[model samples]
Target chain A: MRGADILRFSVHALKGYPVRSVLMLVAMAIGVAAVVLLTALGEGARRYVTGQFASLGSHLLIILPGRSETTGAHPPILGETPRDLTLDDAFALLRSARIRRVAPVALGSAPASWGRRERETTVIGSTADFQRIRHLKLAQGRFLPEIDPRKAAAVCVLGAAVRAELFGPEAALGRWVRLGDRRFRVVGVLAPQGQSIGLDLDEVAIVPVASAQALFDSPSLFRVLAEARSREDLSRAAADSRDIIRDRHEGEEDVTVITQDAVIATLDRIFGALTLTVAGIAGVSLVVAGILIMNVMLVAISERREEIGLLKALGAASGKIQLLFLAEAGLLSLTGALLGLGLGLLGVWAGRELYPALSLAPPAWATAGALAVGVGAGVLFGVLPARRAARLDPVQALSGR
Target chain B: MIRLQAIQRKFVVGDQTVYALNGVSLEVEHGEYLSIMGPSGSGKSTLLNIIGLLDHPTSGQYWLAGKDVTGLADEERAEIRREKIGFVFQLFHLVARLTAAGNVELPLTLAGLPRPEREERVRELLAAYGLTARARHLPGQLSGGERQRVAIARATVTRPEILLADEPTGNLDRSSGREIIELLESLNRQGLTLLLVTHDPQLGRRAARQVQMRDGRISGDGRGG
Candidate 1:
C-alpha cells in the first residue's frame, strides 16, 4: 500500500478504538514529560550555583590558610598549618605587579549590643579594599579607612540584619556597640544581600582586620582575598600569592591559593554529573512507556485481526500490513512526545513563576533527547506486534478465529 | 485462467491428518461464471481458497495465468491475489469503521492508485452499485443488502480478472439475497470470471456452469440451465 493510504487507514483504526488510543497516548506522554521536567530541574540547579560562583568576583583569587592538595599524609583538621598566615603575609602579596590589591579576612562571632538590644553576629574583618572587591554596597555611611596594619581602628560596618536588630528604627551610623571587651563605632550599614555562594551576608558585621584579631584574641587570619589587575594576571596573581605566603611562613607553602574560575569549574563538573544522573533516572519511565506501547499494540492487533485479514485478502502484502501498524505506532509516539514537550515547558514556566531566582528552562539537548527517545522506544517496541500482524494467516483471521 | 492438478490440502486435527481437499483438480477459463455446491465439510470453500491463493495446497501443482503458482513465494502469490483476484464473503466483511465509499476504495488504494483516480473509481463503482446516495454511510448504518452491494463494489474496484465469492447471500433476507445474486450475475456478464460457493441449490443453479462436490472430490461438473 502507498504510504499515505497506510497512514490514513491506521488513523482510522486508532480512532475506531478511542479508549485504547487515549490510554496509550497518556502513558507515552507522562514518560516524556517526566524526562523533560526532571532534566530542567537538574540543569536549572547547576546553572544557579555556577552563576553564583561566577558572580563572586572577576579576575580574583581566594587564598586560604591550609594546603588543599594532599601530600600522601594525614590531613590537618581545622586548617592547622606550620605557620600563621598573618597580615604581613597578605600585604607582602602586593609586591607582585600582577596583583592589584589584597584584603585580609578574619572572622569570629561576637555579641553587639545597643540600648538593651543584643544579638550574636558573625564579625568579618578587612581593610578599605574589602568593600570594593567583595562587592558589598553600603546603604549609609562609609567603609573602614586604609590604616596602618598594626593600629586598630575603632570603627565597624553593620550588616543590614544586624542594624535592624541592634538599632531598629534608629540610625546606626556613629553609634558605639560593644564587642567582647572593647567598643567600636558603627561606620556603615551594608545593603541587604540575601545569600551569595552559601554565605549569608545580611547577618554579619565588618571591622578593621586589627580589631577583629584583638577581639577574637587570634593571630592567624582565616583567608586573604586577592584581586588580579587584569584577566591575564589571574594565574600569575595566584602563583604570586602562594609564593608570598611561602616566603613569609618559613619558606613553607602552607596556604592554598585558588583562582575564581577553578572553583567555578570544579563546581560545574560536580553539578553537571548530577544533572546527567537525574536525567538517566527519568529515562527509565520512557522504557516503561515503551513497554506499554507494546502491550497495547499487541492487544490492538488481536482486536483488529479481521481487519488485517481483510487487507490481506484485498491484496496487501505482509510488509504493507506491517507498515500500516508501525505507522500507527509511530504517529502515536510523535504526537505524545510533542505533547510532553509542551507539558514540560509549561511545568518549567510554572516553576519559574514560583521561584524566579532559579532559571528553570530545559536545555536544548534535553528536549531533543527526550523526543528522540520517546519515538525511538515506541517504534522499537512496535516491531514485535507489527511482525505478528504481518504473519497472521488470512484464512484463519477471516474465519474469525 | 486457473488450473489445479491433484491439489491435496491436508489438516492435522489433533494428530489426525484430515484431507480437506483429497485430490481436487479443476480448470477455469477467463470470464467463466461457475458455482461450486456441496454439503458442509465437502471442501468447496477450501478449493476456492486454494484457487484464490489464500491457502497453499499441501502436495500439488497449481498454475494461474501461465505462472507455476504452487511453489511460488508468498510475495509472488500476493501479487497475483492483489492484481488478478477479488473476493466477496458471506458476511459481507465490510470494514465497520469505513464509509461505503472508503470500503470500495480499499482495493484501489492497495494497488497504489493515485488519490484522484481512486476517488473517481470509487465514485463510479458506488454509482453503478446504486449506492451513490449511501456513499457516506458506514456498514453499521447500511442495510444488509446495501452492505453486500458495498462489498461487491469493493471487490471489483481493482478491476480484477476473477471474483471468488463464498456464500455471498448466506446472511441476507430472501429479497436482499436475490438482489445480491443479480448484482454478481451482472458483473459476471460484464466478462469478469466469477466463482461462487453456495449451499443454496437455487443460488447454485443460477450460474451458467455448476460443479458438485462430495468428500472433497468433484462428483459432477456440468453446464447449468
Candidate 2:
C-alpha cells in the first residue's frame, strides 16, 4: 500500500481507541516537555553567568601579581621572587597604542570612623578611569578628581552600606571621614548593587591610588585593570601590556594577564556541558514513553486481531502490515512531540516572566534532539510489536484462537 | 481453476499428531460454483484455508489457474492472492470505523489503485449492491443484510477470478442469509469461480457441485443438486 494509505488506515485504527491513543500521547508529550524545559533552564544558567562576565566588559583585561607556575617558564628561585605590581607598572600599560584606558587598583582593609560611628570597610584605590572601567555608578556626588599619580589627594567614595552606616541619611558628601588615622573627605557614595565575582561593591570605600598606597603603607599595587581600544584589540593589547610591564620589571614577565573573554568562554563551556547533561537526563523519559507505545501496541494487536486477520486475508503483505503498525506509533509520537514543544515553549515563556533576569529558551539542538528521540524511540520500540502483528497466523487470528 | 493432489495437513497436539486434512484431493474448474459441507472438526474449514493459500498443506501438490503454487514463498503467495482471489467471511469482518464505501474500497486500496480509479470502482460496486444511499454509514449503523451485502461488494471490487466464501451468511438472519446466498450465486453465474464452505445443507446444495467430508477426508462428491 502507499504510505498515505497506510497512514490513513493506521489513523482509523488509532481513532477507534481514543483513550489508548491519548494516554500514549500524554506520556510522550511529558517526556519531550521535560527535555525542552530542563535544557532551557540549563542553557539559561549558562547565559546568565556569561552575561555577568560580559557586564564586566568583554574587552577588559586584568593584570594580576605573580606569574602562573606554567610549564616551560623560568622557575621561580627563592631570592628572585616576582616583584610587586607598582603604580608605575599600571601607568606603563598606556605606552601601548592598543590600550585605551587603565586603572591601577590597590586594596586594603581599614577602620573608618566619623564622629563615633566606626566600621571596618575595604578601601579601593584607583585612578579616575576606574569608574568607567569597572562600570560603577555614583548614587550621590562625583568620583575622585583627575590628578597626578604622585599627588596624595585624600578623597574617598563610600559604598551604600558604608554611607548608611556612617552618614545615617544626613548630608555627609563634604564631611571628612577618618581612615587609619588619615582623614579624607567623602567625594561619592556608590549606589546599592549586587556583588560582582567576589567584590561586594555596596560596602567598598574608593580612594585615590597615592592616598591608598600611603594609608596602607605599601608600595605594591593590587592589580592593574586595562581596556583595549576595541574587542579585536584585546589580544594585541595584552601582549603589548605584558611586554611593556616586563620592560619595567627588569625583563621579568612576572604578571598573569586574564582576558574577560577567556573567563566567559570557560564558563560557557561548563554551562553548555551542563545543558547537554540535563538534556541527556531528560532523554530517559523518552524511552519510557516509547515503552508505553509498545505496550499499548501489543494490546492493540489482540484487540484488532480480527482486523489484522482481515487485512492479511485481503492480501496485505507482511511488510505493509508492519509499516501500518509503525505508522501508528510514529504518528502518536510526532503529535506528542509537537504538543510538548508548544507546552515547553509556553513554560519557557512563563519562566521568563517569573524571572526576567535570566534569558530562558530551548536550545535549537535540544529542540531537534527531543523531537528525534521521541519519534525515534516510538518507531524503534514499535518494531517488535509490528513484527509480531505481521507474523500473526492468519488462520488463528481470524478464528480468535 | 484450482487443483489439489493428495493434500495433507497435520496438527501436533502435545503428544499426538491429528490430521486436519488426511490426503484429501479435489479439483475445481474455472467458473465452477462448489461448496464443501461437513460437521464441526471435519476439516472442511482447513481445506478451504489451504485452497485460499492462507494455510500451507503439509504434503501436497497444488495448481491454481494452471500455475504450480505449492512452493511459492509467503510474499509471492500474497501477491497471487491480491491479484486473483477474493474472500467473504462469516462475520462480515468490516472495519467498524470505515464507512460502507471505505470498507468496499479496502481491496483496491491494498492493491494500491489510484484514488480516482479506486473511488470509481467503489462507487460502481456500491451502486450495484444497492448500498449507494448507505455508502457513508458505518458497519455498526447498517443492518445485518446491508453489512453482508457490503462485504460481498468488497470481495468482488478487485475483480478477482476466484471467490472464497467461508460461511458468509452464518452471522445473518435467514432472510439476509438467503439474500447473501443469492448475491454469491449471481457473482458465480457471472463467470467468477466460487468456493463455499458451510454447515448449512440448503446453502451447500445451492452450488452446482457439492463435496462432503468426514475424518479429514472427502466422503462424498455429488452434482446436479
Candidate 3:
C-alpha cells in the first residue's frame, strides 16, 4: 500500500473508535508530560542553587579553621583537631601574587545598645577589605579605614536593619554603639542587601576582626575570605592560601581552602544526577502507557478481526496488515507526544508563575528524550498485537468465530 | 482460468479430525458464473475461501492463469489476489467508518494506485452503483441494498478478473437479494468471472453452473437452470 493510503486507513480506523483512541492518546500524553515537568523541576532547582552560589562572589576562596575532606558537606567530625587560623595566617596569604585581597573573619553574637534601644545581633568582624571582598554596598559615610591589621580599631559598620533599630530615621554614622562592654563608632551604614548564602546581610553588624576577637575572647580567626587577582588565578590563590596557612601553622596543613568554583561544580554534578534519577522514575510511566497501548491494540485487533479478514480476502498481504496496525500506534504516540510537549510547557509556565524565584525551563535533552521514548514505546509495544493480527486465520476471522 | 486438484482441508476438533474439504477437484472457465451450494458444514464456504486465497488447502495443487500458485509465498499470493481477484461478503463487509466512496477506493489504494486515478475510478463506480447521492454516507447510514451495491462497487473498483462472493445476499430481504443477484449477474455478463457460495437452492440455480457439496465432497456438478 502507498504510505499515504496506509496513513489514511489507520486514521480512519482510529476515528472509528474515538473514545479508545483518545484514551490511548491521553495515557501516552500524561506519561510524556510527567517526564518533562519533573525534569524541569529538577533542573530548575539546580539552576537556582547555582545562581545562589554565583551571587556569593566570583573567583572567591574561603579558608576555614578545620580540614574538610569532602567538597560541599558538613566538616568531617573525626579528624586531627585543626589548628587555629590567625591574623598571621591571613597576612601571609596576602604576599602571594595570585591573592588580590584577604579579609580575616571573626564571628560572634553580641548585643548592640545605643541609648535606650538594644538588639542582639550577629556580629561579623573583618578588615576594610571585607566591604570590597564580600561585595557589600555602603549607604552612608564610608567603610572601615584601611589601617593596621593587628590594631583593634574601635570602628564599626551597621547593617540596614541594625541602623534602623538603633537610630530609627536619624543619621547614625559616627555614633558610638556599645558591643559587649566596648564602645565603637559607626563609620558606615550598609545598603539593604537581601539574604545570600544563608546570611541575612541586612540584619548584622560589621566590626574590625581584632576588636571582634577581643569581644569574643578568642585568638583564632573564624575564616579568611580571599579574592583572586583574576578568574584564572582562583585555583592558584586557593593553593597559595592553603600553603601559606600551613606554613604559618608549622606545616600542619590544618586549614581547608575551598574555591567557589569547586563548590559550584560539586553542586552541579549532584543536581545533574538528581535530574537523571527523577527522569528515570518518570520513565516508568511511559512504559506503563506502552503497555496500555499494547492492551488496547490487542482488543482493537480482535474487535476488527472481520475487517482484517475482509482486507485479507481483498488481497492485503500480512505485512500490510501489520503495517496498518503499527501505523495506528505510531499516529497515536506522535500525537500524544506533541500534546505532551504543549502540556509540559504549560506546566512549566504555571510553575514559573507560581514561584517567580525559581529558574524553570525544560531541558532540551529531557524534551527530546521524552518524545523519542514515547514514540519508541508505541512502536515497541505495538509489535505483539500487530503480529497477532497478521497471523490471524482469515477463514476463522471471516466466519466471526 | 482456474483449476483445483484433490484439495484437502482438515481440522482437529477435540481429538477428532474433521475433514472440511476432502478430495475436491474442480475446474472453472473464464467468465463462468458458478455457485457452490450445500447444507451447513458441507464445506461450500471452505471451498470458496480456498478459491479466494483466504485459506490454504491441506494438500492441493491450485492453478490460476496457468501459474501453479499453491506453494507461492504469502506475499506472492497476496500480490496475485490483489491483481486477479476481488471479494464480496454476506455482511457487505464495508468498513463502517468509511463513506461509500472511501469504501470503493480501498482496493485501489491497497494496490498503490495514484490518488487521481483512484478518485476517478471511485467516482465512476459510485455512479455506476447508483450510490452517487450517498457517496459521502457511512455504511451504517445506508440501507441493505445500498450497502450491497457499495460492496459490489468496492469489489470491482480494482478491476479484478475474478469476483469471489461468500453468501453475498444471505443477509438481505427478498427484493434486495434479487437486486444483488442481478448486480452479480451483470458483472459476470461483463466477462468478470463470478464464484458465489450459497445454501439457498433458488439462488444457486440462477448461476450458469452449480456444484452441490455434501460431507466435504462434491455430490453433483452440472448446468443450472
Question: Which candidate's DockQ is highest?
Answer: 3
The CA lDDT of each predicted structure is 0.87, 0.90, 0.89
Candidate 3 ranges beyond 4 A from true positions: A74-78, A111-120, A153-155, A160-187
Give candidate 1's total backbone clashes: 0
> Looking at candidate 1, what is the lDDT of residue A123?
91
lDDT of 2: 0.90
True-structure Cα RMSD, model 3? 2.3
Q: Model 1's chain B TM-score?
A: 0.98
Each candidate's interface RMSD, rounded to one decimal? Answer: 0.9, 0.9, 0.9
State every prediction's TM-score relative to the real structure. 0.95, 0.87, 0.94
Clashing pairs in 1: none
DockQ scores of all models, one per candidate: 0.78, 0.68, 0.81
Stretches of candidate 2 above 4 Å error? A66-100, A107-123, A148-154, A158-172, A175-185, A190-195, A198-203, A209-222, A229-233, A236-254
> How many clashes in candidate 3?
0
* lDDT of candidate 1 over A1-401, digit per residue (tens): 67788888878988998998888888888888888888889888888987887787878788877876421112234455446678988899999999888899898999888878888988988899998888889999998887886678889998899999898899999899987777999989999987876568889988899999999999878888889999889988888888877878778888777788787777777877887887788888877888998999999899888888988899888998888888989988888888888898999899999988889878788889989999999899999999999999999999888
- Reported per model, the fraction of native interface contacts reproduced equals 0.72, 0.67, 0.79
lDDT of 3 by residue, B76-117 (tens): 988888888988888888888889999898888889999999
lDDT of 2 at A386: 95
Winner by TM-score: 1
DockQ of 3: 0.81
The interface RMSD value for candidate 1 stands at 0.9
